[model samples]
Target: MEKPLAYRMRPRNLEEVVGQQHLVGPGKIINRMVAAKMLSSMILYGPPGTGKTSIASAIAGSTKYAFRMLNAATDTKKDLQIVAEEAKMSGTVILLLDEVHRLDKTKQDFLLPHLESGRIIMIGATTENPYITINPAIRSRTQIFEVKPLTEADILTAVDHALADKERGLGDYPVHMEENARLHLSRATNGDLRSALNGLELAVRSTPPEEDGTIHLTLEVIEECIQRKALTHDKDGDAHYDVISAFQKSIRGSDVDGALHYLGRLVEAGDLAIICRRLMVIGYEDIGLANPAAAARTVNAVLAAERLGLPEARIPLADCVVDLCLSPKSNSAYMALDAAIADIRAKGSGDVPDHLRDSHYKGAKDLGRGLEYQYPHNFDNAWVDQQYLPDKFKDAQYYQPKATGKYEVALGQQKNRIEQWRKESRQKPR
Candidate 1:
C-alpha cells in the first residue's frame, strides 16, 4: 500500500520547507543552528499541518543525523530508551517528539540525560502553548521556536510543487486543475498544507478524465473533496477579517439583518468554531449587563452548537445571533474594567486596604489586618460602605452603569441611592 501524497511530499531538506521564513530563512535561528552544525533540542509549537514535522526531518536530513519520531503521550519511556540507545550507537539522533507538552515526569527524567549528553537532539512539536503546558524541567533544557501558519501563497507554492514533482507527487497523473480550483484549494484549507494536498490528491484521483484522457479538476470537485465552499473571504485573507469585523459590529449595533447576513457568510465558509467563539465574546463584550439573560442564552447556544457539530450547529448559532442582535447592547462593564486595568498599568496596583486584608490567619490581628473592618452583613441592607479600595484610589470610580435595559436601569437606581446615602453620611462624618 502506497502512502498519502502529503507524507510522500514532506520536505526532505530546509530549502524545500514552505513558509516559516522567520525560522528557515537566511540568518534565522534554525538556519544558523544548521549552518553551524551545533543543533540544540527545541520545541516547535503551533497549529496543525504547519510544517513542524517537516522542519524536524529537514534538520536531520540536512545534518545527516539519524531521525526518529514518537508521540509524547502515547509512546512509552521504553521508546525513549530505544531512541537513546540508537543515539549512543550513532553518536547523535534527532527525535521529533509530537505532543511534547504531554511528556510525563518519568519519560522526561529518562530523556533529560540523553539530551544533555547531545545524544538525542529532541524536536518537540505541539499545538499547545508550551510555556503553560510543558514542565519547567524540560523547558529549561531546550530552546523554543514557534511555527506559524502557512499563507495562501505558501500553500499555492506547495500545491504547485506537488503537482510538478514526478516521483513524490501527482505529476504522473494528467491533472489539469482549473485556476479557480487551484486558488480555492489554497484559500479553503485554512493554511493547512497537508489538507490542501490531500484535497488536491482526492480531487485528482476521484475526478474523471476528459475525452482526451486528461484529468480535469474543477472548483466543484475540489469543494466536494475538501468539504468547504469557497467564500468571498479567504480564510487567511483580509476579507475574512472584514467579514468577522462586520459580523461583530452588526450585532453590537443591533442590526439583526446585517448580522444574519454576515453570519450566513461565515456559516457558508464552514467556520463554526469561529462563529461560536465570536458569538460568546459578543455576548459578554457587547450585550453585557444590559441584557445579561441574553448573554446567558448566547452562552447556552454556543454550548449547544459545539455539542451538535456543524449544519445542525448552525441552527442554534443562528438562533443565538438573532437573539444577540435584537437584545439591547452595552459596553459599560468591559469599558469600566478596562479603565481599572489602565489605572493599574499606569500607577501600579496599590496594596489592598488594611481592613479588606485577610483576617483569618493566626498573626493577622497582630499585623492589624482587618482590625478596622466593618462586617457589611451586620449592617442594615448588608451593604455598609467602608474603605474597600486602597487609600490611593479613594476617589477612583470605575463603574458607570448604563440604563439600557430594565436590569441596568434598576442597578443605576440603586447606585444613585447609594451615592446619595454616601453624600449624606460624608456631610456629617469626621
Candidate 2:
C-alpha cells in the first residue's frame, strides 16, 4: 500500500524541510547548533503542520546521536526511565517528546533530574504556550525556538516539489492543476503543508482517471471534495488571525452585526478557552471608560465559555460580541498609558516626586520625601491641589475623559469638583 502524500513527502534532511527558515535555514541558530554537534534540549513552539516533527526527524537522521521517540500524552515515567538508562549507557540520546504539554506535573518533574544531569537531550513540541503548560524547572533549562507558519511562496514551492517527485509524489500521474484551483487550495490550507497535500490528494483521487492514466484537477472536482467550505478563520491556521482581526475591528468600528459574524466564525471553529480570554483583553484595552461594561461583559463571556466548553458557551460569546460592538467606543485610557510609556522610555526612569514618595519609612522625612504633601482627606471635600508629578511633567495631562456612557457623566461631575477646589485654593488668604 502506498503511504499518504503527507507522510510520503516527509522531509529526510534539513534541505528538504519546508517553511520555518528562521530556525532551519543555512547558518541559522538551530542549523548551526546541529552542524556543530552542540544541540541542547529545546522546545519547538508553534501551530501544527509547521514542520516541527519533520525538523526533529531531520536532526535525528542526520546526526550521530541515538534517537528515541515518546508521546507525552501516552508515555509514562517508566518509559522515560528506560530512555534515561539507555542514554547513560550510550554517549547521548535525543528524546523527542511530542505534545510535551500534555504531561502532568509529576511526569514533567520525573524528567527534570535527568535533563539537569544531561543524561538525555530533550526536544519537546507543543502547540500550547510552554510557560502556562510545562514545568518551570524543565522549561528554564531548555531553549525555546518559535516556528512560524509557512508563507504563500513556501506552500507553493512544497506543492511544486510534491508534483515533481516521481518516486514519492503525484508526478507519475499526469495531473494538471488550474491556477485558480491551486491558489484556492493554498489559501484554504492556511500555511499547513500537511493539510494542503491532503486536500490536493483528495481532490485528485475524486477525479476520474483519463485515457492517458492522468487526472486533471478541475475547479468542480476540487470544490466537490472540499466537503465544507473553508471558513475565514480556521482556529488552527492563518484564517484564525484573519478572523480575529475582523472581529476586533468590527467592535472598534461599532458594527454590531459584523462583530457577531466574526464571533460566530470563531465559535464554530472551536478555538480554545484561552483565545476567548485574549479577546476579553481587547475589550478592556480598546473599549474602556466609554463602555465600562464592555470589559466586564467580555470577561463573563470568557468565563462562561470555559465553564460550558462550547456549543452552549457560544451563546454568551455571541451576546458579549454584540454588546461590545454596540457600546460607545473609547481608547483614551489606552492612549494615556501609551503616551506615558513613550515619555518614560524617552526620558529614562525618574525618581518619584518628593511629595508623592513614602514618608513612613525611617529617614524618609529627613531626606525631604513627602515634605509639603497635602493630605487630601484633611480638606473639606477629601480633595486637595498637590504636586503629584515630577517637576518636568507637572502639567502633563494623561486621563482625559470622553463624553460617552455613564463614565462620562460621572467624570464630568468629578471635573467640576476639581475645578471648584482649585478656585477655592487660589482665593484663600495667604
Candidate 3:
C-alpha cells in the first residue's frame, strides 16, 4: 500500500521544511546543527502536524545515522531494549520517539544511561509542554525546542510541492484544484499540514476522474472531505490569547456582534475558565465604574458559568456579554491603579503619613501615628479632604474621571467638588 500524503510529503531535509523560520531558517541553531552533522538528543514540542516527527526524520536523513522510530505510548521496554542492542552494534542510533510525554518510568530508566553515554541520540516529539509533562531528570538530558504553527502560505507551499513532485506525490495524476479549494485547505486545517495534505489527498483519490480524465477539486469536495473545520485555537498557545484579546476589544469597542462571535468560538473550544476570567476582567477593566451594575452582573454571570458550564452556561454568559458590550465603557479605574503602581515601583515607596498609619495596636500612639487623623463621618457630606496618599504622592492626581455616561458624569460632579477641597488643602500649611 502507498504511504499517506503527509508521510510521503515529509521533508527529507531541513530546507524543505516550510514553517518555523526562527528554528529552521539559515544560520538558525537547528539549521546549524543539521549542517554540522553534530546532532544531539533534543525534544521537539508544539501542537501536532507542525513537523516534530519530520524534523527528526530530516535530521537522521541528513546525517545518515541509524534512525529508529518508536512511540512511547505503544513501544514497550522490550522494544527499547532491542533498539538499544542495535545501537550498540551500530555505534550510535537516532531514536525518534513520538508522544515522548508518555515515556514511562521503565523506558525512562532504560534510556537514561544510553542517552548519557552518547550511544543513543534521542529525538523526542511531544504536543505537550515537556517542562510540564516530561520528568525533570529525562528533560534535563534533552535540549527543548518549540515548533510553531505553520501559516497558510507555509501549508500552501507544502501543498504545491506535493502536487509538483512526480516521484512520491500525485504528480502523475491530472489534479485540477480550484482556487477556493486550495484556499480552504490552506486556511481550514488550523496550521496542521498533515490535515491539509490528507484532506487534499482524500479529495483527489476519492473523487472519480472526469470525462477528460481530470480529477477536479472544488470547495464543496474539499469541505466534504475535511468536514467541519475547527477553530484555530490551541488553549495554551498564541491563538488562545489572540481570540481572547479580540473578544475583550470587541466588548470595549461596544461591538456586540463581534463579542458574541468570539464568545461562540471560545464556547466551541470549551475554554470556559478563560472566558470566565476574561469576562470578569472586561467587567472591571472595560465597563468599570461607568456601569457598576453591569460589572456586578458580570461577576454573577461568571459564578453561574462556573457552576453551570457550557451549552447551558452560555445563557448567563450571553446575558453578561450583551450587557457588557452595550454598557458604558471606561478604563479610568484600571488606569488609576496602574499609575499608582508605576510610581511605587519606579520612585520607590515613601513613608506612610503618621495620620494614616495604623495606630490601634498597643503603644502605637507613641510614634504619633493617627494623631490628627480626621474622621470623614464627622464632616458634612460624609467627606474630608486629607492627605490619604503618602506625603510624596499627596498631590498626585491619578483618577481623572471621564464624564462619559450617567454614572461617571455624576462622579465627575463630585470629583469637581473634591478638587476644590484638594486645592484648599494644598494651600494650607503642612
Deviation in Å, model 2, residue 222 alpha carbon? 5.0
Rank order (by lDDT, best first) = 1, 3, 2
- Of 1 and 2, which scores higher on TM-score? 1
Worst 10 residues of 3 by lDDT: 228-237
Candidate 2 worst ten-residue window by lDDT: 227-236
184 Cα displacement, candidate 2 (Å): 4.4
**lDDT tens per residue, model 2, 277-302:** 55787787777887777788788888
Q: Give candidate 3 misplaced runs (Cα > 4 Å).
A: 229-250, 257-430
Overall lDDT per candidate, in order of appearance: 0.90, 0.78, 0.86
User: Residues 154-221, candidate 1, lDDT per residue (tens digit)?
Assistant: 99999999999999999999988877778878877878999999998888888889999999987779
Task: State the displacement of the C-alpha of residue 231, model 1, in Å, after optimal TM-score superposition.
Answer: 3.8
Best by lDDT: 1
